[model samples]
Target: MGLRPRMAISDIEVIAPHFKRRLSGVTSTVVQLIPKQLEAGVKISTLGPGLPDDLPKLRYRDLLQCWVRPSSGKKRIWHARRNIEMVAGIFLRDVLRMPMKLVFTSAAQRNHTDFTKAMIRRMDGVIATSGRSGAFLEVPHTVVMHGIDTTLFHPPRTNDDLFSASGLPGKYAIGCSGRIRHQKGTDLFVDAMIALLPHYHDWTAIITGRVTAEHEGFHAELEERIAKAGLTDRIVFLGEVDDVKLWYRRFSLFVAPSRNEGFGLTPLEAMASATATVTSDAGAYAEMNVSGSTGMIVPAGDGDALRNAIEPYLADPGRAKRHGENALAHVTTHFEIGGEVKGVSAVYEATLAGER
Candidate 1:
């Protein structure tokens, strides 16, 4: 059937779907984008489960109405961040004969699976989360790096402060957060902390994340190793936390030593919080760190390199503070969520204009 304008005034112009029940990079992206997009005057809503109830939501039944072309003679944008959501878009746009535009934002920095490639090839448009991720894509795509909420992550007021009022005993805490596994290099962070903290008594290294059932042994081994070094008092494991942004501000230096990632955002979040960052050259971390200029970037999985990168900051807290300021300025200039929203809206407008 030929395309026609949406009949209802309540139709959502853009829909960001959260299909899974778990919190992940995809869900976080969707959650962060909605408020910014809405501020820019886009009639957007999220569908499916797992999203916070605060943001506007469109019921799944409402999705059927979005099958028609939207008002202003434009195609409704259905942005998907995962394989299942992509498949749903295909069903809505191709199988169900919907007039929506199918868009997928890929954050995987590695090669695409044959099945994934097949699904991606059918998208009306593709958005790669980074140039590294784009390089692995077999289809034409736009590169839009994720941005941080600078308002929420901005530097703390003067005076060293306790984070989340948890009374964690350090003037400055160094933290590495994410899923605890070999791929995330949590053990590397542990080893680096064990080697460094005895000398720099003022700073304590902390790791915050969930160790899934499969990685329990790996987590236990790391903890045992930390205990053996008599550094358990210096190296703390907070597990998963809800007030992570608050914790980021308490960190004078934030470490992300992942052996692999898909454009990791923790470093950016740290920078936005005005914290110096040390990251391995996995994902687009090198892009975020700017080497010694903004923060530190080291070789991935090299415990020695990670330790070396952090010592300079530990040795000179003044330098760490200045680096944190530079990081804040850099993120405000280049990585604010406002800029990301603008980029996505530009793509949406172009897609509506029939410029694939």
Candidate 2:
């Protein structure tokens, strides 16, 4: 595929591996085809704790003009210091020589108030991932919805071999993907699964992703709760997988029980794979899921609501299939990767052209 005009995005912290993969995949594909189009470059390259050092290097001319910011001592308080660092970094590294337009992705790694003020004072433009996130910034920022690789996440074309292979043949498999942490509300998902176990015996819950050390105790606690609920035979925890598209294909239903998300992309991926979804009304879930139109949404942190939202689908596969088909159609129409690239490309052009 040919690259559109090049624009650099900051926020190098791989807070989520999937997020990093999407960013790198999208940008690199565009850069490969139209290397010269990337006149405006990205900076602030920070990596995750254990990310490989041999990652491929980007070659846009403006990329050579960029520099990464040094992280501070109190990493948890990094957001509070990020605005100051961003302003200083921009002036010293990007603005001293020439006036190049910038398109900052996330907030300045600081409190919303501080980050908004910093953005207003520093950046030439902004592209927020969701309306709620954009609202907090209170800038002339555009709500640029995230995109998914539909080709990679499309409906399964093969047989249900994986279901039988995982010993779940003839049973519905509900899957949730994300870091197994407190903020993600994996405990809530566990609670819901526990509640549903007595009623639904022909269903399994598959949770995938890595668990943080800070959440080790919580993980243990959840496991004990699952065992107590006698769901050991019903719940499967598959640690991080290289290809999540495969997981989505195998799942009959996808659940996003997160407490907060800037803009949940997992549901979009699942929808693309033609998997019905039940997400908490957290963050951007409402915008992504149309209640009964695309998929169902339950109140955040409410295990009962989550369980109820999922029970109907578990009882009726035909309705679930209809919801999944609708979801796939809805996401395809609204969140195509080409549209995302075009929209972002427009932002870059307008920014560079100084078209407020």
Q: What residue pairs clash in candidate 1, if any at all?
A: none
lDDT of 1 by residue, 186-274 (tens): 98999988888889888888788888899999999999999999988878998898778877888888999999987788999999998
Regions more than 4 Å wrong, model 1: 1-9, 158-166
Q: What's the TM-score of each model vs. the native?
A: 0.93, 0.77
Candidate 2 Cα outliers beyond 4 Å, as residue runs: 1-89, 92-95, 107-111, 160-162
- Candidate 2 per-residue C-alpha lDDT over 60-120 given as tens digits, one digit per residue, 9 for 90 to 100: 3433333442132111101111344345435543555432344565522224765457655
Candidate 2 CA-lDDT value: 0.64
Candidate 2's error at 206, in angstroms? 0.4
In candidate 1, what residue range of length 10 has the lowest lDDT sum?
1-10
Q: Give per-residue lDDT, candidate 2, residue 243.
A: 72
Best by TM-score: 1
Local lDDT at 212 for model 2: 71
